[model samples]
Target: MALKAAAALDVELMSTGAFSIDQLMELAGLSVSQAVYRVHPPSAGRRILVACGPGNNGGDGLVAARHLSQYGYEPTVYYPKHNKNELYQRLSKQLEDLNVPFVNDFSKALADTDHVVDAVFGFSFSGEIREPFPAVIKALEETEIPVTSVDAPSSWSIEGGPPMSGVGSNFHPAVLVSLTAPKPLVKHFKGRHFIGGRFVAPSIAAKYDFEVPRYEGVDQVVEVMPGGKALVR
Candidate 1:
């Protein structure tokens, strides 16, 4: 259900012309930053390591790193597969304008940052883990630093959680921000969960028969997991 719903929602979102890729990524990234702040604020520690891939999910991470930097948090981006697309180039330029450092050593970045935002993968991810990312995911799994994954954790399936053993088995993020809606794999998640996409139209949601949790006041994100920690601001 989650995999199908996610795929359908993507199609609907793109086909309706209601939102552009930039708009969607901005909103999603903003929500991801907010979720990270709620779970691990700058006061905890200022340094943030945003691990990114080469897809839209990586774009979300790049945007989040910029927002986090504006919020007084020092963010470093670790993007292995640098995208050449104009959209991603723009995102990279934005981060570069902020003077945010982009690193190549995942282990070093992981050891240096206070928190990690796992935006290496999303709902559309499939098949076995590829180069660079397997090492990145392994580093994430071994790290003690708290992680906040954007949409879905890296290497996790949209329907199933982490694998029973091996690489992704212990790669649980401390906080998760579900974009558009919570996927079925979320049921297996054991930590704080928040819904991030605020642009989902009521008609579309109804059409899909999925509930978008009510956000508080003007907040872009809403906590869905019971007994979750309070929002920072």
Candidate 2:
């Protein structure tokens, strides 16, 4: 999806009054956590690091980390700049209640964790890599550990995909779980991909002229083939 279209769709969905930010975040985060579990199960390694920013994307990370813990994974959150929004506070509190640890050492996290969840940025992000994140993205680019990014890869443009060179250039996420629908930047990604956000109404999809993946049963997401087909089995 184009950047504008994606933003507009979010607005339209909220206007319908059938959904709230909390509901959407929970579903999207669950889908993200499910994707992580599917690709890198707890049997592989239980210590997962979730890197969260200060936006809605970070909220998704918080929610995903919570679900990961419920699924029996030892998940840690790396939240540098926290969002003060009530929704985000509640999400963080849920993790605290679960006894999940929050860390500030990105270097130690990179060395200690098995997998990383890149929820530091979303489709709305633009411009050069900012403070705190430069070190985070740099560490990620240099790490051998696999990553599962939620929505958009951190520091990537919604239209241009990953940067050609510099901080985010060499950082390739092993898995990407796009919410609502795959954005235009996905065309440049060559990895395991999945689409979450099953809340898109049929009329909204038709109005936007995009196809929603046929989610099986009560599944929250479906794998998207490189050719853009949903692997619905």
Candidate 3:
């Protein structure tokens, strides 16, 4: 459903060649923020560290930070400096308007946070972790706080057949907010065990001709199709 909407939008925008990537980034960010609120409602004060990247993923994080600020939660965003071009500049202006704090260092920011939101990398990512991204991943792994990945866990893969090797350490999120349709790689690589612990994909808009069931109060489970039974612990 989300894919359909995104594809439609992408095609429409590409046809005109006037639409900007920032718009898509904002949509993704808003979608993630809404999912977070649904899973964990905001209170008077709670600290959330949003780990963002230099690409569209970071832009989404910026959007989430701004919305989170509006809801009265203190959100600190960490991102590496890069020439993000005009789209990012626009996002930066928006973040500045919302007064969302941005940091280039992860150590200090991670030290003082209640929860971490992994907006660093998305489905489009491939290959090995490079530079500061690896450092950020390492820092996140060291933290005891719960982490919520926007789409899939960073450094994840679904290829290379069964008995997969070299998958990253399981940083089980208290909740994972998947946009549109869930990424196939996440389920393929991590299997049901990873997602069986608090995963959610929002309901796509009605115009899209599809709907995702409301996951509210739903139990997470792994199912075996042959017997048509759910795995229980």
Candidate 4:
């Protein structure tokens, strides 16, 4: 359902030349903030650390930080670098305008955060985490605070394999806030066991009439072959 909605929106947005990449980034950020609010209700004096990457994922984090600030939560954004990309530059400037404190170091920034928002990676990632970000991942692993990942963990793979499957234990987000539908990586990978034990697909709200149903009754059912006689006495 989430995939369908995302595809629909992608088509509509792509058709319009006016729709820019920045708009999509903002939408993703806002969606993640909403999910955070749903999972962990806002409280007084709570601190949130939003870890952003260098790409659009970082932009999403910046947007979420802005929204979180408006809700009266103190949000600190951490980005790897502020480069020349127009969208990225815009987000950096926005964060500055909002007076949101941000840093490039993962260890120091995550020191006292109550909640960690993983906007460091998105669905577009395919290979292993490179460079200093791997260090950042390692640092996040050591922290005991709850984590909320945006879309899916950065290194998760749709295709079944060693590295793909191996990453399940690496990212243990307390709640995985998917944008549209839950990605195949989120379902196939053991992320539910590790980081995001609570799987949340927020786009379902826009696509479906009823609320997303929780998994139930798997233990109560028994499979029977066609034309087989009942085993019960």
Candidate 5:
């Protein structure tokens, strides 16, 4: 359902010349990084481990790693699978130019990091948890470190968590920034929930019956859920 709506929006936005997918991805990732900064402020020793997948979500992680480095946080990327897609290849090069290390060992990244950014999955993910992803997602869950998921938690259902396959392991995020609008899965999230992607036009919001939270002027992110009930302000 989320993917269908997203596809529709993409067609409308791109065909009407509002924006391209690349542009949207960049904006979304930038907002994700900004939310990460708000939740885990940059400090000398605070390092972030950004776990990325093979899809556009990984592109977002790479983008986040770049911005996090700019914000003074040491960020290492852990992208195990690589797609031949030119978009991802370009993003990888951008991260390389920024000198952000890509760790082959997930455990090593986890050991050296202070926080986790689970960009391993987005709203489009379905099916049973796969091999490497399951292992990696397990690591993210089993750890005591705080995690900040982009869009949605890895292995989570679009409408609810635990996945429709029943692989939920109490994956909790310290912060989540739902691009465009909060997904239904966010109802299960008990941490800080934010709405990003300031470019989402109000008309789209109305069409979707989306009561997108209003951020103070010029703000890129707005907290809609501090804990339980959604807040407008």
Candidate 6:
């Protein structure tokens, strides 16, 4: 219903609001970068390999790479599918402009990184894992590095928790950044879970019963503590 509610809000905004998906992508990426920085502050020359897909989730990764670069974390992007989306291209260009390298070799990327931001898939992923991604997800699972997944961990159900087989057996991420609000999968997570995207209009939020965590201080991402104490305003 989050997608439908967003569509409805887009109509309500008409031309009066910044309803573009790219604008929301920027915010999403910003939130992910901020959360990653806060959760695992980069050390001198610490590297983060952001595994991005071809969709908006990848755009989020590209955007996060840009911000992570600005924050002094050496972030490399491993975008397998470009998909040629204009917004995604623009976001990727922004990252390249910041000197973030797009490394194609997943094995090399995973080996060299201290952390991984799993933006390879979001809430809509289903079915058995495919070609390169199955291998990529496998690499992510095998690596001992901590991973901070954006939206939801890859290879998991959008409506529920982890997948029943394959890499999911070892796909426990260290941190999860749930845009807008935490998903039902949050209940199965034991690590630090954060809620981002606080710009949703009150009417939209109320209509969907989207209870979001209030961002603390100047941070745009707020940690959703256990017991569902998600500090909603």
Best by lDDT: 2
Deviating ranges (above 4 Å) for candidate 6: 1-18, 230-233
Clashes of each: 0, 0, 0, 5, 0, 0
Q: Ten residues in a row with the worst lDDT in model 4?
A: 219-228
Q: Pick the candidate with the highest TM-score.
A: 2
Local distance difference test values of all predictions, in order: 0.88, 0.90, 0.60, 0.61, 0.80, 0.79
lDDT of 2 at 154: 91
- TM-score per candidate, in order? 0.94, 0.97, 0.69, 0.71, 0.91, 0.89
Note each model's CA RMSD in angstroms: 2.3, 1.1, 7.1, 9.7, 2.3, 2.8
> Which has the better lDDT: candidate 1, or candidate 5?
1
Clashing pairs in 6: none
lDDT of 5 by residue, 61-103 (tens): 8888888888888889999898688888888888889888988
Cα lDDT tens digits, model 2, 1-233, are: 89899998888888873778888889889999999988999999999999999998999999999999999999999999989888998999999999999998988888899999999999999877788999999887788899999988898889999888888988788899999989998988898999996888889988888898888887888998988898757
Return the number of clashes found in candidate 5. Answer: 0
TM-score of 1: 0.94
Candidate 6: C-alpha lDDT: 0.79
lDDT of 1: 0.88
Candidate 3 per-residue lDDT over residues 1-233, each given as its tens digit: 23345457345443553445665566567666665564556762378888887776677777877777777788888878643588777777777787778887788888888777888776566667788887787776667776777666666532321123433454445555555444444344332212221222222234444334333344332222222233343
Candidate 4 C-alpha lDDT tens digits along 1-233? 34455455445554542455666667667767766765566772368999888766677788888888887778898886655887788777887888888776678878877888888777666566777777777676667887877766655543331142333446666666555344445554333221111222344334343233332332111111122221231
